[model samples]
Target: MFVRSLNNESQLLRKIAEGDQHAFKIIYDYHRRAVYARAIFLLKSEVLAEEVLQEVMLKLWQSAGKLTDETNLGAYLTTLTRNRSFQILRRRVLEAKTEIELRKDWTESHNETEEGILLADTQKILADGIALLPPQQKMVYELCRVDGLKYEQAAQCMNLSVETVKSYMKLALRSLRSYMKSHTDLAVILIILKII
Candidate 1:
């Protein structure tokens, strides 16, 4: 019975790969709840889990053509969810560490006037860079980086998944770095800001 069920799933995958939207919907309906439950269990955040669910489904749709009969859909989706969750966690840790290092460096610097001037300039550049971000990214960056909210807090405030928050922070930092690099000699300050 187990092997038969596997065979049926494989057939469904094959049909999905052949551009059968009906098969895809069937598979989605069958798996989405379990996938969502797993994501919530692993991430402990409904918002992030929902985001993961959407991302996982989008991946399934985009990669349906590449799935072979041997592909284990459950395992594939599970692994994707786990990987994405870990990625968000890792980014949060790195951001925290960078923030700590920046604070320490800033506090220990003796050249207060020079550092102040540079920071003021960097803040202006940052504001300009932030203006270029999409609204969601800008809000996420402000809540997490500017307002010093934890990921969970920011997620709650923004009504976003932690993963989505992290993704926005990543994009915002990338935009800031590109902008700062091009506009000023504050490359060192940019490094200190380290939005990665």
Candidate 2:
């Protein structure tokens, strides 16, 4: 049975490499849920996870010609998904909002000043901390917080159950807490960790 499945997958992969859109769609539809699950796991945001899934699929299609074997297609796809998801998370961290006080440093008639540069550095730190969160936690947290989706909504979007979403969110919070411990106070951490 396993061998037959493997053969079928190999044939599908060969068809995909030959620029068969239907074959690519079959492969994508089969793996889309797993890709989203991984993205949600790493990113803590449903919206971002969805975005990552799209990006991953697009890249996969573009690189179909390079798929040599299907015996480990899942692993290869997972690696690609992880790399892209991390990229999104890292970009989010690098672009975190500035501290309110720092924002005051910028004027309508803006001046490029040393303070602006320092503010940018702080934003980068916040972004890095966010990027450090475990993949699943990041997706759940982001969906709830950044995207303002309720747990149920987020879960639906991620093709996960509400309980699973809650579980993921809990795990994400714990991991983020640990990751950001050095940079946060108890009160602020509590605020961020609050499940809504």
Q: Across residues 1-196, which tens digit of lDDT does each residue of candidate 2 receive?
A: 0111334677787787788989888888888888899989999988788877777777777776777664477777789889998887877776664545466775667345854664555455456766877777778888887777778678867989989999988887666556556775564444444422
Candidate 1: tens digits of C-alpha lDDT, residues 84-181: 87887788789999999988777553676877777777777778888899999899988878766667667867888989889888988888778878
- lDDT, candidate 2, at 38: 92
Highest-TM-score candidate: 1
**Candidate 1, residue 41: CA error in Å?**
1.8
List residue ranges in candidate 1 displaced over 4 A.
Answer: 1-7, 108-196
Candidate 2 to truth, TM: 0.48
Query: Residue 6 lDDT in model 2?
Result: 37
